[model samples]
Target: MMNYHKRFHARMLFALATMAFPAMASAQDIAATTAPASQPQPGDENLVYEIAEVAGIVKVASIGMDPIKDAAAWRQVVPGESLGRGQQIRTTFRSKLKLVARPADPPTVILLENSSRMTIEDLAIRNGAAVSRLGLGYGAIRAGVAEGGVRSDMQIATPRAVLSKRGTDIFRVEYMNGRFNMSLSEQGRGLLQAIQLQLSNRGDVIGMKSRFVTPGQQVTHRMAQAIESMTFDRDININDIFGLVGNDKLFTMLNDRGFGFLLPFNGASNNIFNGQGITQGEDGVAPFNNGLFNTQSQGVRSITDGNFGVGQGSLPNLFDIFRNRDTQPAGSKKSMNEAMRSIFKPKARPRLNIGRVRR
Candidate 1:
């Protein structure tokens, strides 16, 4: 007679089923008058970590600033949920998350994506090592550090930058599309695995130019019109840009309209970054046209991502992507990031000063 509602939902199926962060059932309520604070009261012993892996759409709020009055105050961290220390994990619009701070030996994985917001400021065990300290606060994270025999002190803090465990294996921080992402790779010869990001913005730590990132390899940062020196595009070789989009037909019409992650077998080689080939305005060097692998020099322009526009005469134009499939945006993810932000959005030339015309 022990079925306790299917054993309490098999202990809440241990978090990570996937897809379900589309909360907008109309938000208009916020009058709790400082009353909601107990996202962990059902025997929460500050357990630390245990939501192993989740895919798409997630929510958990043990807020740190206090002020909740809607979205039923977010509460769903199935999968043996046990977290601790002011939790706050979120992922909406094509969600993906994985948190396994420690299952045994040397495991520490916390990969989140899609409109993210992470927090777990400190998980202890210090003096004996294992001192994770996260706080992304915005979006994008990928910290997978295994090779442990014991002794780990992971740390990621970003308002601008601060990622620790410097010997490096894998640790990421992102809040891009606005730029300021940065990769720290000194490894990789012929990538089949990629996670290269380099975006930039400056404010603190002397507006960070480069603050020692080389534990494993994969960094991204640039913006503020690219100040330059992220190691000159880290040797620019994503399989030489997928050997220059090998299988043509406009690369299968942009891999049948997902723009095959913009290029390269389309997975940053395979470390799974997805896409990014931007370089715009004011001589946005190599905005996919540094002789784009010279595709037979049969010129014909019009490549846009500044907001949408594509032309590649003599071939590409592939019927202009059905001219607007009835105002897209279904299944959200802003219609796959507006076709991955106009397939690597970067169409420059807007750096004006009104200078010379000296004939």
Candidate 2:
């Protein structure tokens, strides 16, 4: 006999999953609201291109009115060299903290070291008091206080920034020594991974989360890994590291983090975009009848659609190898973009023959 009860439940669950499509659409709208307005238009259905790419004619839009342009002069936002006096400003990445789990009983601690001599107050993470009267570092205290929680040392400070979590799952954020810390167990790590994927969109750090964890086990492990991975002994050139592309704010972040820019494609040598200012094919100028920055009539696809498949048929297609080699590649041979091309593309060259060749 068929199990009618189980079959009925299975049908009910399938119906529920089908009904969840509307919720998925709403979540996409939320993601769109969080995206920067300066992102480009790619005329594809429900697909927004990243900041760097441009159609044959690039569309330019400012996220917020440029303060310098709005005020008719450069306004002083921050004052000093090291994150100047009025340096604190709102950014896309909010510096807020969220509390995930708290034991029914919270612990406390006391302060140990405060450097009074410096222009800015220097508080050691280890030098804090504790309710259990246990040892807690300055990092732990900073992390706790920043998250608006009590450190192991009993020190408490509220975080200035706020982070938005998509799910009910929560975690802790702390600052120690000079580093930021995040703690998540297996489930917590899954939530953290979701957050990180939304933030950076890279899956390199996948499989790093866990279900079971102590207070600081996962955070401490990640922190140690970050420190050990640094190659401080090797010298790096500041300018060489930060390639010139994207917005100035992204540039600033890259510089602050000691990273340089690298475009996904060697756009510099790609003659596909040549003739940007040509009367005819004679001088290699493109007769641009279209406006460069038309968002409304030819705007980017919104995230409202569940289809986030951008690179498939959504983006503007670059010319094929044969076409590019005969026409576009001609102008790219002696260009300074050779290094860029080689770096952006490290695969073996596509074999081409003068006559017909076997595939």
Candidate 3:
């Protein structure tokens, strides 16, 4: 009986050892894997993008030189965190993320809506021009390039097509399943070009096709199909793109963060009324559209009369408000540029009424 009990005990010990071997091996394997890549150091030349804002659940993964062996795990992103090339970002449902490409003179602002995934394939200053390349795995993103002297080379690659832009522009790209769509906002100053690659069954590139999409236009493509172009419907506003309803906090946050320029206004003129009922041109439109006022009327006119609104000069210009810093609220010590920059700085930012709408 003693011998039999000893044999049984030995058998149980062997079974337990066998069961723990795989777990030990897995632990060692995990330890052998590379650790998460560290955040880019300040003033790093490769540091081209920064997280300006984050809402809801958003995470980022840093892909190392050997993506397979050294890919970093995803972690929550914080505002003002800088990202270099090979950084990938994703958002969960009802989440949003804002990124700024600092290489550009005026900086390019990119908003990634909910359920989106994107990778910063490349971002560098090439020959004094900001060159950016992005890969969209799925979902949607809106990008606005501020007007500047140097033309920027920005390209977004989707599964169906590649959208390229030179210079300042505002555009949105969405990719889902096998469908791809790119739309240029009516306020954009530059054109967007789409390139579609024709590949063989083995994924060998055989030929390529291209199309130029102008402001207020859109291009779309499906799986292995020809690209189609159409006019972008003006009814779709920023609120619609972000799937927000009345008085959404995200909308208010965007305005406070200096991204109010992206919000579309009704009618042809990009004007917003101040509290005093005075119409003011949006700051973004004033710099690119030649002047603070849009002479074009929304109503159809049979006769071409440039003298419609003669007294419109009385209306305040958006830039004028910023240029005249004396008009700022009392006790504000920061300049207009400093105030704008403070919006991105967590410690220096001031709390503003988010419910207030601004164009």
- Each model's TM-score? 0.22, 0.17, 0.48
- Cα lDDT of model 3 by residue, 1-359, tens digit: 96566556644543453355432212111111212323333443443788899999888886543324544577789999887766788888989998887655756899999999887766666565666677787999899988776557677777656777745478999999977888899978777876555544644334445667788988777422443333442333332222222334234435544544533345344434221222343332221121332223322221222233432333344555565566777667667667556444557557586877566
Q: Model 3 reaches what TM-score against the true structure?
A: 0.48
Clash statistics: count for each candidate: 37, 37, 0
Every model: Cα RMSD to truth: 25.7, 29.4, 30.2
Q: By TM-score, highest first, what's the ranking? A: 3, 1, 2
- Indicate the residue-level lDDT of 228 in model 2: 47
Worst 10 residues of 3 by lDDT: 25-34
Error of 3 at 300 (Å): 41
